[model samples]
Target: MDAFYASVELLRYPELRGQPVVIGGGRNATPDTLADGTRRFKRLRDYAGRGVVTTSTYEARALGVFSAMGMMKAAQLAPDAILLPTDFDSYRHYSRLFKEAVATFTTQIENRGIDEIYIDLSDLPGDPAETAARIKQAVRDATALSCSISVAPNKLLAKIGSELDKPDGLTILTAADVPPRIWPLPVRKVNGIGPKATEKLAAIGIETVGDLARADLELLQANFGRTYSAWLVEVAQGVDERPVVVSSEPKSMSRETTFERDLHPRQDRGELSAAFTDLCTRVADDLRRKGYEGRTVGIKLRYNDFSTVTRDLTVPLPTADAAEIRRAATECLKRVPLDRRLRLLGVRVTALLPAGSYIAEPQSVQGELPFAPD
Candidate 1:
């Protein structure tokens, strides 16, 4: 999927084609009907909340706006950009359509969230390029959207190749292409190498994939520890042996909201409590819908400074009950120091088990008997 959310929005408002458009506003930003019956959209300049960019069109990207950027700051960059609220239902609908379309060709697919997937095409009989083309076409036919496809020997190179080209792109790479193509790229381009690793690599004069590949084994081990160091060397040489997992179980379900304005925990206690309760209710509903119950209930708080904290409490029994979840979340919340205004609040349920499954209590230690044996 290419600029997925924005592209989906384009299907609804084709009139905004080739113009800078952003998605992330609340329901209040929905397009209004004009006297002439034309839809008038809210502009980024007119946005007044603390909402962040969920996605933006390539046209918006041209003006230096990107996803996860604050809407207020993005407005300064592309003030005239059209703003639209997120429609996750439509996004999920297209996600299912595209995945189902691809499944018709091959079932060995690893879903990487909603917009991306990894399909094992090694068993398929055809040229890799042709197979990629077919998959791309199938996706487009299913959803009326364009997606970039990259076919490489393994997941690492394939992921890198996928981003080499933009909207509606097809890229093919092999192990032979690693030295010439992958080595010259920055170390950060590797799948597992994140900001902290990138900074560490830079400090040690290992900025590019080539640099990492040629770095001394001893130097890497001394810096990144034995396990990660060895893994880093193998990945730099394009040696990813991990197989694509075809399926996975859900580990947790959660609901969260970022405030339009920072809300004080004490001053805005009523509003904060309402939002917290709503999040827990939503999480409970999600658990029941998905047929799971969780033993660990948690709360996440993000202060106005962008710092975040999370606390979790494990209960004796797993539950999908809204009141139980809320109670657990409230207990976790009590552990956090709310000295600053909160920008975001979230509730999460983890340590999941199938709903209605038998749960046995832990055996009590003999020496640690009730009342310490008096």
Candidate 2:
């Protein structure tokens, strides 16, 4: 999908193309503290108290700014860097276009997110690298956008390989190619490796992938525990065998909102319930739009302290009704102790099946309410 959100914005406003542009915040304000070490950040206008940076353009990246940086700090770095509000619906439409374009090359496409994808070109025509180039060309020809691609035997290296080039790139690596290419890079380059893990690895002088490859597995296991230690070693050695999962199913569907201020349930029941109902409606809309009906309905709450909790229920039948989702969510909420103030609230649906699959057994449940579109 390329620089999806930003690219789509660029297409709409061609004047902003090649300029540093950012998408976040209201009309005239920006966020303040974006980094407190690592990548966690907050916005300036949001300082008192805001939003997260969904995505930023390449020009913004040159100013030590990036997606998720606090809006205020981003303002300081690139104040005049055009600020635009996020339009997720527009981005989703573009996502479908690019995804369909890639499917023309291979059905082994794995949707990474609204912006990225992993296409397995192993069984496609011509050489793998050539096929990668062709896929890149096709995406540009179809969407008027460019993307980076990596072709390897498996996903681990392939995911990493795709990012080696920028904007429009094509990089290829095989099992035999590791030392010169993968070793010198920072451990953070590994997709799953986070700042915490990188810091832990650095404490032991394991900076590069090569260093990790040579480090004692017993020592790594001692520090990182069993699963992560083994995964690190395999990634370091380019031994990933995970296949490209072609059938991209929704793992979960959710909707969340950040408040202007932390709200207490008892103190602000009316406002809170209104927000909750809206969230449930959005989640249900997502479920119906995706042609899925989920049995598990859950609620997620983030407290003022920033701690989070989730409660869920598996119903007897799958549904995509807003009121039904809200009832299940409210029932789940009772299980959670609402002693603290809440900064965010969310509703989720999981355990999904195709909506049509549940049509034959329409059993009615007593005491359950029905949802109507608002």
Candidate 3:
């Protein structure tokens, strides 16, 4: 999907297409319909929040807006960008449509997330490029959205290749193209080479895929150890033997939100309480939907200065009741310092088991919220 969340929002308000649009605001950002049927949207300049960008249109991206960036920072970059609240329900509906469309071709699909997937076409009889085109068309026909795709020899290359083009891009990469095509790119472009690894690679004069590919094996081992060094070298050469996994299990479920403004635990108790309860409820709903029960509930708190802390509590039995998860999470919250204003809060459930396998039991939570006044 191209700018997925923002693209979906464009479908709802076509007039905003091609404009710098951002999707991460709260209910207050919802557009108002005037008597003449014109919609008035909130602008980034009008936003004053601790929230982060969820997704942005390419138009917004051109202005330096990107996901996970501070909303205030994005506003400074693209002050006129239209702001809209997120609608996960609609995004999920479109995700189902695109995945179902692709399933018509072959079931060799490995779902990476709501936005990305890996499809194995080696077993399918046909030109892989044509198959890729057909899949792209099917996705657009089904969802009225564009997706960037790449037909590569392996997952690593495919992942990197898919990102080579933007909006509606399709690139075909092969072993012959690794030297000319992939080598010139920065080492940071590789999936597993995250910020820390990139920094380490930079410090060692390995700036590009070509550098990593030609790097000394002994030097890499001395720096990153044999296991990771060997893996890095192989990835630089575009070798990924991992198969496209068709099914996988999740170990945990969680929900978290960054507030539009920092809320003092005591002064903003009502808002904090509402948001905390919402996170617990959503996490419980996720467990029930996925046929799982969790014995552990946890809480995450990020203070105004951006320092984060977490605590978890394990219950006697696994269950998916929202209240039980909330009760456990509240207990965890009691164990964290709340003297400062908070920018974010989260709830998580872990130690999962098949829902029916657990004996259902609800535990009572005593006392008011530790941060709140009764």
User: Candidate 1 on 100-216: residue-level lDDT in tens?
Assistant: 999998999999987999989989998879988999999999999999988988898888888889789999888999999999999999999999999999999999999999999
Better of 1 and 3 by TM-score: 3
TM-scores vs. true structure, each candidate: 0.88, 0.86, 0.93
Compare the candidates by lDDT and give the number of the best one. 3
Question: Which digits, one per residue and each the tens of the lDDT, describe model 2 over residues 194-291?
Answer: 99999999999999999999999899999999999999999999888787787778878999988868999789988998899989999999898889
lDDT tens readout by residue for model 3, 278-323: 9989998888878999888889999989999999888777879988
Task: List runs of model 2 lying over 4 Å from the truth.
Answer: 26-49, 266-271, 337-339, 359-365, 369-374
TM-score of 1: 0.88
Supply candidate 1's per-residue lDDT for 349.
Answer: 96
Q: Against the true structure, candidate 3 has what lDDT?
A: 0.92
Residue 250 accuracy (lDDT) in model 3:
81
Please report how far candidate 3 places residue 119 from its true position, in Å: 1.2
What is the overall TM-score of model 3 with all chains considered together?
Answer: 0.93
